[model samples]
Target: MKTLLIVDDEPRTRQGVKKTLEAWSAGRLRIETAASGVEALEWMEENPTHLIITDVRMPELGGLQMLERMSQAPTKPVVIVISGHAEFEYAHKALQLGVVEYLLKPLDKTKLIHSVEKALELEEDRLRIGRMEKLLDPKLLEAGQVEAKYGQHVRDAIAYIEGHLQDPIGMKQVADHLHMNASYFSVLFKEQTGMTFSDYLTRKRLQRAKELLAQTRMPIWEVAEKIGYQTAKYFIKVFKDSESVSPTQYRQQVSDPEETIK
Candidate 1:
């Protein structure tokens, strides 16, 4: 069962969140609460939690400061921030910090529940992927014989690309990491993955961007930056070239209830 930690100063808010999540979790989750950021941090350090839902304002340490401190922890727990302040600056900073969601106070029960559900789903997906990677690592290592001796190297390259897809990754950089010539590495990557390295990277980035677009109300520019495109124009051009539709159009289409139902 996954553990959830709720951090809020108000007793009413804390009880409200606990009751909501307990119901949403369907008795399959463990719930814990802390009255302030300091207490939350201490509890988190002492106990393992899969998700944290915290308020932006507290008596001692604010949510942003707590988030910054949590970033340095060995286990990176998923975080959702709720604030009464709807200032653009607060939302922007929360997004920049990679928070799963920045919700407004006087929380809508449905929205809050949905956000927690999504965060838990993402956590499960990540754990499953990690397990699959562990199982696949040995097979990849064994595949280097009778084919290309650099097969494992190519696999490493792909893993590296996946991990750093949200950052700038060029063919030359990948080749340098593998200590091989760019021309040879490019050929090897294509032969191994059945797609050009650049294509793979772009596809991965686009997939990630798509998920963010579907799940969050983040601006296109922020989404572009998160997926490693510095220029929103270029990002949109590439996305359109690949999907044959603009990002906004794609998002709208996916978000339409009738279209989704159909």
Candidate 2:
């Protein structure tokens, strides 16, 4: 079972969140509670925790400070920070701490659950990759057989996808760029990358959209358009489907709270 820690000064919040997470995980997690960040760190010294859900403004050794201490460790736990205050400083500090999500309280159950699920999924991917690397030569993995796995057309298609992510390009356009039939290119891409052309393109666009959202205080519509989204509404829906949060919410979780974003 994966270990998860809940840190909050409030007794009710600590118990309530613990219960909600227990119900959501259905016994998949070994959940523990701490009344303060100091207490949390004390317990963590003897335990291995995969995730932490912490309140930002505890009396002594606040969540961010606890995270700063954790950062010096060999491995860092995935963290989700919750605060009653949406002060720019808290959000900014949480982002600097590499928090998985920053939530404003009173917590929404759906949002909390979605955030936890995403954090765990990412942790799983990290651990899986770590294990694979442990079992292989690091240099060989760094050299990456992924390129050797792809055909020249697929590589060119990937290059095209990366270059034209800001453009409203489609599979037909990309296939025509390589002077190949659309149907042939589609099959080749799927066989090579194990993902459909549309899926690959969407993934890349969303990745760029995330970076832009986090790094720049751009409006949602502009961010969407820059990633080939024609409309903000459609982009919001697609982003929420993949990320379990709207673009606005994701931006809120990651961006500078002092700077208002449209």
Candidate 3:
């Protein structure tokens, strides 16, 4: 089932649209309503919906501004703009913002149904295409081929980890990314990499840290943050433990070839 949000300042219009869509959906759609664009945005911060039916004009955060803010979201909902005939010019701008459908005021049931179906269909297509792209990501399939110890699934998981090394990524996140059970992913990861997930992540982060220390002049704390460590002290401790030297010492050694030779 898909969730839809209706945004209108008028209570009658909001509830009317929600009720109509609910009746037509036959449990296929979960309908929600907001009296204004501000309320709609507040609801969206907690619950993301598949589609939004928004009036073009409202006081205190109009529909266009709300759509602008939503553009920065990691996943954006399909939008259908509702406008009075006088607001036809504003509807054109909504189209520029990628509103999927432009609906006129005093909506017809048949047109509303058609637009809703089309928007949902498009949403499904977008999701399917996204999954397919992730599955067929060339870099994901290509990494770790030199050892061939891990299967494609493990390789894909590794790719996700590497790509998101800056984030506070965890084993569960990688497992979810690969669509596997956390425990099962842990076992498979150990079998394929010959190390626990934590160890592998630590090793990778250290490796990245070493590269950055040698290749760039970024501060130690910044490097730690970039490589997913929350604090430089912890990163330095781990680095010393794993390499028998602190990050500073390693950087000095790698940066000065003559000192290393001596």
Candidate 4:
């Protein structure tokens, strides 16, 4: 079951919202509450929730500040901000912070339910896409489907990218090699690959890094350079951002068969 966190300085409001959501969701969601934004952040560090419904004004670390903190986290829950008429400005800032919904005080039960359901739907979609992307075969570049749809130049580009991954390969370089305009090649690449050229290159580099981490005992810095990253620090950052774990952590989890050699 998905978890939901309700944050408010007022104990009565917190419990009332929690109880109402529990009843409306009919136990489909596991609901929790925090008396202050500081307490909510502490809880989030230990437990991740699917959604957070927070009051704007609190004694310490109000809703907006909490969101700014959460943005730095590796994983963040969807947020719904609740504010009064006087806090309209705060609610507007929350919208800019990417709150799924901005709710005015004297909360309407129907509107709350609708917002909660919509957030859940969006979360489900996000999770579904993440799972699908993980399962997608990067090796599909060599498959016949690529050539059938994008014709030979795109296929050749993929082959070139795979062959020259250690080189400084850019869209313009690839386009020049293929005898096509860079702008046209970029658009065509995205249409056929369903991702921008830069994104595709990054994914390829990441995939190679994962393989090297899992199957070799190479120094992390060497692995980074081999995959076209200029520095281990930047490579580690990109790896953690994409995989939610550092390269050392990932390597520790996956046993390397060649680890015994050398």
Tell me the deviation in Å of residue 137 in model 4.
Answer: 5.5
The prediction achieving the highest lDDT against the true structure is: 2
Candidate 2 lDDT by residue in tens digits, 1-262: 7888999999999999999999988999999999999999999888888889999999989999999998888777789999999899989989998998999999999999999999989777766554333234332233235857788898888888888888999999999999999999999888777778898787778777877876688999999899998999999998889778888777666543222111
Model 1 whole-model lDDT (C-alpha atoms): 0.80
- Candidate 3 structure lDDT: 0.81
Root-mean-square deviation per candidate: 17.7, 16.8, 17.5, 11.7
Output the better candidate (1/3) by lDDT. 3
Report the C-alpha lDDT of model 4 over 1-262, residue by residue, as the tens digit: 7889999998888998998998998978899999999999888777758889999889978889999987866556878998875566776788788898998889988999999999988877766554344434454454435566676788889889999888878999999999999999999898887888898888889888877876689999999999999899999999999889899987875552112111
Cα error, candidate 1, residue 253 (Å): 42
Pick the TM-score winner: 4
Off by over 4 Å in 4: 86-88, 137-262
In order of lDDT, best first, we have 2, 4, 3, 1
lDDT of 4 at 201: 87
lDDT of each: 0.80, 0.84, 0.81, 0.82
Q: Candidate 2: minimum summed lDDT over ten consecutive residues — where? A: 253-262
Pull out the clashing pairs in model 2. Answer: none
TM-score to native of every candidate shown:
0.53, 0.54, 0.53, 0.56
